[model samples]
Each structure stands twice: as structure tokens, then as C-alpha cells.
Target: IMRWNKNIRLSCAYLFRIKYNGKYLLVKGNRIDQYQPIGGVYKYYASFNELKTKLEIEDEEEINFYEEGDLRQITKGKYLEKFLDWFDTKKNREVTVIRELIEELHIGEISIEQLIKSMQIEYLKTVKEEIKFSKHFQVDELKIFNIYEVRIPDETLAEIINNDKYSLVEAGEINKLCFMKKGLSTKISETSKYII
Candidate 1:
């Protein structure tokens, strides 16, 4: 019999597919070093401190500065199924895309009302990265991402963001493997293609 470790790393994130003119919007990645969709790991509120300890979940090894409390965590493998059930309850952890939308898009100066009126979004699909041993992190990680499509009714944001921080690439070219940078094209992150 093949024996596996009874340890797991669970993570969940919300990603948005913000498209315009037949191209998808991608932001330069800071963590893995390539353009990626706009969204990040879910965060849990401090009120769940008790459950956090019980599950033995901790911050991901990656450096994070966002402040809420990283939901990317480690726990005994035996708790994996149980934890997922709890997550579905939508208790204690973040369940909205608003935080990431505002933060990633640099949406400030405008109230939530403005933000809401400017765009339309709906649930798209869930991309599941089942439990697997990550050689880089040396932990078995299980990740789930809820994707949504954000459609801007006007050019409000497209006109505002005129910087290199964001890049719009054709849908067909997204998986072409590389995005040009500084006149030289380098390989893009594989995760970006999974969204399609």
C-alpha cells in the first residue's frame, strides 16, 4: 500500500475575468513573476481565531501584506474533507469579490456605490486545483478559485488605467505561452491559461 502523509495545505481565491475588446486583462504578478488575472487568496476574519487554531491552519509561506489574515493554510490531511464542508458554510471567511476588486483595480476616491454602478459581474465557474504535492512549497496543496466576469458598461476604467501595471491580451493569444516584455517576449505563467 502506498502511504501518504496526513497533512494538507488548503487555499481558496477569487479571480475575475475582466475582458475588453476581445482581450483579457492581466496584471503583472508579484509573487510568481508573470502576468495573471486580477484576484487573490481569500482572507478569514479574526473572529474565527478559534477554528483557525483547531484546524492548525497558518499563513502561506509566501509574503503577504494585505492584512485580513491569509486563508492559505496547512492542516492535517484528515481534516481536509471536514474543512471544505465548513468553507461551504461561508462563515468567518471572506465571501465577496469586492475587496479584491477595489484593491486590485486601485478603485479609490469613489464610494462602493460608484464601484457597483460602473460594472456588472456574475459568477462564471470554479477552477479546482486538487490536492497535490508541491515540490516548490514542499506541501500538499489543495486550492479552489471562484471566477467571475466583470463587464464594464463604459470606458471609465479602461480610460483611467493607462499604465504598464495592466496589460490586455487577446483571448486566443493568452495561452500562446509568452507575453512580450521590454521588446522581448518571455513565457507567461501557466495558471493564466487555466482560466480559459
Candidate 2:
């Protein structure tokens, strides 16, 4: 069963352990040197009613019709406190994961469908609640890093890397993926342990 952290904050993020053929997919962006899983920070939005009022959305049905892109645009410049909400609900978390898999990872619909079918939630690390202060903002984060692994065909895996904004790294070069050790301490410490 999937666990939802009621205290999820905007500073919190998700990362996938997309495994295929003894290798895991780690991504490095054009700007960043560190290679990490394909995921991003979760954004909060207003309640359906509040969003409707703020966006001047009329039809009650249309109020809940916003897609991921639409939601981002509509919520721009809005205070998180005024609209912040958690994936406290199971359905909300599932939807967020689906969206993240598609949007952030660039996983195709067919591949994503297959991947979801094989996903199993495994608890990897749990950091106790603490106040994190940055240069611009501060947040109390009770971060829980979870791992979800799925196997895919070699061809499909190649396609994912070639077609997406990510580059592939060999399983032997696990150290390139910075957060791997932080999250998957024991399971990924030795390449032999994870590659197989």
C-alpha cells in the first residue's frame, strides 16, 4: 500500500527508481551536474471552490477540469498559504505521481501504463520532522523517501533516454547519481546489490 505524508510541503519532492535490465535511469539536466531520478517538487493549489473563485471560472463542472499545465498557470503569483494543499488523499497522490511520471520523466503513455502496473512502494528512508531554512524561504519538512521500481524492455528504455531530456548512465557508475546513497543507503551501496 502507498503511504501519504499529510505534512507534504512545496519543498518536498518525489524521485523514481526506474529500473531496467540491471540498470536504473538517472537523469542530469543541462544546468545541473548531479544526476538524480526524474521527479520534481510538488506544487500546491487552492481548493476547487477557491480556485474557481480566483480564476473566475463559472461552470461548476469546469472548476475541476484544469489539467496540470492549466493548474500551474492559474495558480501563478498566488500565495501558497492561500492555496496550499496536501496529497493527504490517496487519489490525489496517485494523480500527482501519474502526472509527474508523464511530465517530468517524459515517459510515454504505453510505457507509463506498463510501469504503473508493476510499481511496488518500498520505504527507503524517513527523515524526522525538522525546520529547514534557506536563503529565501523556510519550511518544516518531514521528508520520507520512497522507492518504486519497475522493469522495462531494453528497447523501450533506450527510447526513453533518446526521446527525453535525460541521458543514460551505466549501472557501474552509480556514484554519478548523487542522491542514490542518501535515499537508498543499504540497497544501493554496492552496485552489485542494485544492478541485479
Candidate 3:
């Protein structure tokens, strides 16, 4: 899933090249419950060389569910071009951006790129305990890295450490993807940052 504010018309797709059992696995999803591809957002390493390393680690950690095989990206270059346009211009809401990803990149069924994007989106939705919430729920928290103050804590962050390793998810606050997009008027202001 991808997130761009309401002002930007952009889409994000998780691209994956996998060969398992001689058959490729593709993931797809929508607002409704269903299976989607697996993968996370890339904050750095926009180039293919750098992205490949990020993809490798993610594949080993998450995409490994798919049959074993070589990994590659069928969707090359301009991977974030469409989304960047909106992200650079309008400053859209993170949730809206992810929703747009659900609407645009979901082709026929699920794919690696879609899956990674979806996973990254889900990871970012997690909130910290200090944040207050009207309701209590359990969700896994995903960490984000700021290039300026990059450091690794005891826990492994969902975010990529090296730009050469993975692309970073644009949303850092983790507040944007907190609420479930059940409808158009879904208000997340009251929700705790910790709720995913």
C-alpha cells in the first residue's frame, strides 16, 4: 500500500521478481478482507543496485513464504515516479496515499511488490504505548529511520538502515495508517498512535 496526501494523485506498487516451483506468486488486496502481496516500504536506495540488497533481506525475512527461487524486480525504474509526483507536490495524507495504492496497483491478483508495499503500510500503522487511545488493541510496531540521525537500537526496526539496503516508507509518524479505512469519513484523530 502507498500513502500520499489528498492533494497528490499518486500510486505505489511493491514490485517483486520471484520464481517458486516454477510458478510465480502474485499478491493482491482491497479495502475488503483478502490476501495481498508481502513486502515493505523502501526509504532509501532508489537505485536498483541498492534496492536489490534491500529486496534480498526482505525476501529472506518475509517473502520467503513463497517457494525458493531467484528474486528480481519485473517493475523497474520509475518505481515511485507516479507516487513521487503527488508526494512532492500536494503533501497528501498518508492513509489516503496507501488507499490509492490499494486501488491502483492491485492488478488481477497479488504480486511481490504489492505484498511488500502492503506489509510496510501495515508495519507503519503500529503506534507507541505512550500515545492514548479511546480503545485498546494489539498491533506490531514498525520503526522508521531518519538518515540524519541514523542509529540501530536493540530492536530491529521495520525501516531500512542503509539506503543501499531498502527504500524507506515516506510516513514516519505512524499515525497516518492507524485507523481502518472502513469508509470515507473514518476519523483517526481520537485513535492512539500505538494502534495499528
Candidate 4:
């Protein structure tokens, strides 16, 4: 059985399957030990402007607003629209995925242009009309998880390890680089088999 939260709103996440030498890349955040995919939550509205009239600002000049239940309902459509825009932009997907890889895992050798040229996008699956519950909040998300595979040479992998952007811990110590296949999971707010 699934629990429902009345405060549910839409959210988007990306799951990258960065494969090298047969295994896929898995990352554990600085604060946690459990490894997940190399992705993060995509914030639909970085600022109040993106919300437009959906979110009522008390002060139109300063964009002051109270955080409450009604605000979630009002902004649900904006979140859904942002996710739909992401879904429709195929080329943007490749670029954003590549940028995220570089930012998260420090996979810097591959450029956006090169990835756009050589990357293979496998539309894994979609989870529509699902409500994900957490301790902090609940989200009714149309989550789409896709796998991106790119082959990198040994030297480039070494470069990633030496870079400052690669900061993941493994085995109670800082790991230069590591890849695994079994424990790989998506960056969804809720745990589901669709991610695998």
C-alpha cells in the first residue's frame, strides 16, 4: 500500500549511467555512505520570476511570499511545465547530462559537443502519476530516468580523479575513482524498481 500526502507537488530528477570498462558510475554524497546515481534534484523555479503568477508574492518588488500549503497547489502547474519542457528538449538533455557529469563526478574530458555527437540515450522508463513520500515533504512526480553511456580512455579517468570536483567517499576513506554495477540506484526521491 502507498501513503498519500495532500501537499504533494511535482519534482524532476536525472539518473546518469556513466559506464566505464563495463561498470557504471555510482556516487555517495559527502554526508552519506549509501551510493546513488550521479544526479540531483532539478529545481523548477530558481527564483520568483520563474513562478510568475503561479506563486503569489506579497511584495511584488521584493517578491516576498509565505511558505504554506496553498503555495504548493498554486505552483504545481509550473513544476509540471518545467518537467515537460525538459522532456521535449532532446538536445538540451544531452548537454545538461554532460554538464551534470562534469560538475558531479568531475568527468571533464568529454565536452558537450562530443557527448552530443557520440552519446547514446536509452529511454529506460517513466513513472507517471506516482506520489513519493519523505520525512521532509511529498512530491507527485512524473519522473523520467534515462541511461547515458560514454566510453572514456584510461588517461581521462585519471584526470577526473586528480580534479577537485570529484569528492565522493568510499570504504570510510576518500576514493580517487570507483565504479560498480550491483548497488547502482537512481536519484529519485522514492525508491522504486523502475530506477534499476
Q: TM-score, each model?
A: 0.86, 0.45, 0.19, 0.48
Q: Is candidate 3 or 4 superior in TM-score?
A: 4
TM-score of 2: 0.45
Candidate 2 wrong stretches, greater than 4 Å: 1-10, 30-33, 43-45, 48-96, 105-131, 135-144, 170-196
Q: Give the higher-lDDT candidate: 2 or 4.
A: 2
The sequence of per-residue lDDT tens digits that candidate 1 reaches over residues 1-196 is 1213466777788888887777778888876667888888888898778887887766666555333487777788766766788888989988888877777775435555676788888898888786789887787778888888888755666653566878877766677867776887855666677566
User: Model 4: per-residue lDDT, tens digit, 1-196?
Assistant: 1312133343344665454544444555544444555664432333334433444222112122212211223234334445355445542223244556556644557655644555455545444544444343333334444444445555555555455323323322213223332465323122222233
Q: What is the lDDT of residue 49 in candidate 4?
A: 40
Q: After superposing candidate 1, which stretches have Cα over 4 Å from the reference? A: 1-5, 61-68, 107-113
Number of colliding residue pairs in each model: 1, 0, 30, 0
Ranking by lDDT: 1, 2, 4, 3
Whose TM-score is greatest here?
1
Q: State, as a TM-score between 0 and 1, how close model 1 is to the true structure.
A: 0.86
Root-mean-square deviation (CA) per prediction = 2.7, 10.7, 20.1, 9.0
Model 3: CA > 4 A from native: 1-6, 26-32, 44-196
Per-residue error (Å), model 1, residue 108: 8.8
Summing lDDT over every window of 10 consecutive residues in candidate 4, give the lowest-scoring window.
57-66
Query: CA lDDT of 141 in candidate 2?
Result: 27
